[model samples]
Target: MSNYCIDIFEFGRHKTQEVTIGDVKMGASNPIVVQSMTTTNTNETEETVAQIKTIIDAGGQMVRMTTQGQREAKNLEHIKAQLVKEGYNQPLVADIHYNPNAANIAALHIEKVRINPGNFVDGAKKFENIDYTNESYLEELEQVKKKLIPLLNICKQNKTAIRIGTNHGSLSDRIMSRYGDTPQGMVEACMEFLRICKDEKFFNIVLSIKASNARIMVHTVRLLVQKMNEEDMYFPLHLGVTEAGEGEDGRIRSAVGIGTLLMDGIGDTIRVSLTENPEKEIPVANQIIDYINTKEGHDAIKKVDTDNYSPFKYTRHQTNAVKNIGGNNVPVVIGNNHFTKDSDYSYIADSSVIVSADKKEYPVVKYSNSNEFDFNNHELCFVKIAYSDMDDSAIQFFKQQNNVVILLTSNNSNSTIEQRAAFLHLRNHHVTTPVVIHKLYDSVFDANTQIQASCDIGPLFIDGFGDGIFIENNTENQSLVINTMFAVLQASRVRFSRPDYISCPGCGRTLFGLQDTTVLVKEKTAHLKGLKIAVMGCIVNGPGEMADADYGYVGSGPGKVTLYHQREVVKKNINQEDAIGELVALIKENGDWVEPS
Candidate 1:
């Protein structure tokens, strides 16, 4: 069971009925608490507080103003007074990147102080490219802890919370060297700060583990939550998909990444970051939190909300598309139960096993035996549904059949016949197999949801017509044993291929239209099928990274580019203006060109 009955007081700062910051309560557990940082000069009190109030009125729960210099620190008291006089009570957070003393001074008026451990570690800012052979990461971490103590002490004295945030691009050399620029490395780095907080007996630390990729952000949170949950560190998780670009992509990526985790009951708090207006953060956060809490089977959390906002209404079509595999005609299904987990299967064939949430049983065999299934193949899986119960052998037989499409169904009382039809349409469009229906219900919902197995077989149906079909439960259904046999009869033909467009991040030595060149190549080849092209900044990792690309466009210098075919440098000094065309020619020469869109 989820620990949804959380005592909200344990996270960060405690606030009740609006603690001091301008209408913001750090611990009130508001449905949507917004926070944003100012890009303005901190010393500019008139401009800074004007921006602060604007953000406050825009529903910003917290505002952080950069205190980069000593002079900026001196301007803190003035900024604080101006904010107070303006009647803004939202918590003020200080963004201190370099100077620790700035954190000490800013804490006088701010509610929270954030410091980059990488910045203060060695009293130096190196290129951040790690030296792997150094083997002195623990030493550097010790130094970092030493540098952070005074700053943390100052914050403690001032009753301020600290954010232990990590940046992937600007990582500490020691961490990067040891962890090799991965999310786990970043988590370890944040954990170092948590260790200090533990030692100091401070409980006011909020942790943020961020990476540039949306996928990485999700994975990082999973890692952090997994680590913490195993040991049970219940610190508040501040969510952000860092360096997420402005506009729809940013919004969608943030929503998907953050929403996925929130659905899994992960995030304690969130920040929707974009290069857009700072005020835009609140609405986005509100939408996400509301969507998560009010979602199906999440009603208990929803009832706690004062606003009574409706949950996100995704079309059944959109929700069904969530599990499309290789654009096949048949959608795959994993038992909605423990059989879905990758860890349970000793020999994973076309099936997955879900680990039981209750682990009172001693071994995997004992657990499987206790359940209503036979673990003969062990590769065959079982999913728990509202009414369906089958022996483990029967479940295995069902899984062994390749033709049986498993559509994960829900037990929502409101799930309409139209929704089921829409789901079927989506499944058939994505996968080329007969779908078997299994309806799983939330423990809270009534356990009477029924499954209807329908076979509407033909050549691939168009999306519009499929969209129009209404799904109803047919009285006739195939037996589990028969379904398994059918699945075995059909072979698995779907293959997972990598997506196109691999562009290298530009470095200092990168010359000649690096960013734009890559963009142009992606745009030109956006419609191309199965073409792997590399747009690299320089020759250092260009050849290595681009090794698998059918064609490569590399920037050697200004007004000059190098083209490669199959990792062998075919031509040098290709004019930058003609580089795209020439790269296309190389792709064609490699027999991988699709006609341009």
Candidate 2:
């Protein structure tokens, strides 16, 4: 509950009531499930079934499809029939928005229904800030309860599990009026609906609170778990970074958010929402879960007081400035012999290292706990310590140092747990010496390794632990290691070296080709760093979902696009062919455009 997992310093899954969804049962100590969703139209049985097959074949444990209307909801029956005929028994979840009837119909046909509480009973968000006193608010809650009771009744009758998903950017006006569009609002939105389900004795429920910002997503999920536990309600959580985009950006972002929670033992299932083939997402999901599961029976780590930490928001571990490496400085990336080779992770370190080290500007020196520590005078003193060495005595010594930069590392099988425990110990003792997280990966170079590296260190940074990161990967591709370091930093909200795209994986409601449009948007906007851009498939959740993005490109119709500067609509209904150009023009008009070198 305090920037932690079930066991904090060790490993254990969070406990929750079991829920049945057709062939798939989730929560409690059940295996962390991997899931994917189709991009095909719901009514297209052949294609939808085809994608679901691909997803399942790729180790997807469950599949979800968009059901926007009654027609599509009815079509699910046919899709389920086709899958059954073909001997596919995996549960099919229907993603419903603003459609209780669709939820009712899909409940009759599918195994689960995912409804966004923001839109379900509140209807489409008018973006209004409604004035409500206690009486009015209570009246609104009664109306919402009445509206949702019927859906819960149907789901209970059909044995269809319901996921009351709350997206941060898309909170209902009623909730926003009171909670002000924050994580609390997202939780309240879902809790309001969940109370209805509980009152109706419908316990077949899972919950998801998501955000495009990895930090917000992790924070909200952690807060949600605490809130539910306070009420003695333990609903299973479905983990995802909603609208996480394609390729490396998407992978890093998803790993940062989803992997952090999985490490905390909070999620029951996950979907790496990438704007690619549904099958392609399954491997990423599998890789993330695999890396996290490796720490399940890990070696014990020494526990420390966590009253200094909060999982819901980030406040960098307090430290005094040591030149450019700590205390208000952006996280620094240190070079190692392996990753800093022909093309090192440093600032051209081969030549730069000699000059910088010779000048005594700042230097990295490995410290041994067995020997009495030596503090020599230099412009800045950088000392490294293994996690095992950061005991009470070492922390007391480092606490008084104004020029110490601690390099923290771990060799345990459960590297993150050990390192996290060490950080907590240091924080509890009020040791503010800047800490740079260091991890060595001797594993093969693959998606699993790439994702594992991020997951191992990501949670520390997200929990506001480290000041810098030092990485070493035993891969011939040094650039891959370099990219991962920056990716972890960016994904942790510690730094940004590339523009972030809050692009959603297109659903059946998507109007045009989503993948290609995302590529085009990235191609034109790659040079525009420090900007958050979203390429959403439709207006349904586009504008609201990418709420933090500096610019948004949302699909308004078939081959038509809408552009936004922040949340304000700058232009609408531009042809898809010219949408990219218009977006650049819009960026230039707003002074965010920059030419690629």
State each model's CA lDDT, in order: 0.50, 0.83
Query: What's the TM-score of each model vs. the native?
Result: 0.55, 0.95
Cα distance off (Å), candidate 2, residue 566: 0.3
Write out the backbone clash pairs for model 2.
340-344
Ten-residue stretch with the least lDDT total in model 2: 347-356
lDDT of 1 by residue, 1-597 (tens): 223222111112212122233344333455435566664668788988887787778776777777766778778789888888877766777776667777778777778777765564543334346665544656666677777788767766777777777655445667666776576777777788878877877767766776444445556666765566555566666776653434333454456556545544556567766545566666766666654454433111111111211111111222222123212223332222223221111112223333232322211222224344444444322322211122345345433544222332334332222223423333333433233233323222110111111111100111111211112222123123222212211111111122234454342335665556766776777667556567765554455445346777877777789988866889898889998988878777777776753
Q: How much is the lDDT of residue 12 in candidate 1?
A: 22
Taking all chains together, the TM-score of candidate 1 against the true structure is: 0.55
> Candidate 2: deviation at residue 433, Å?
1.3
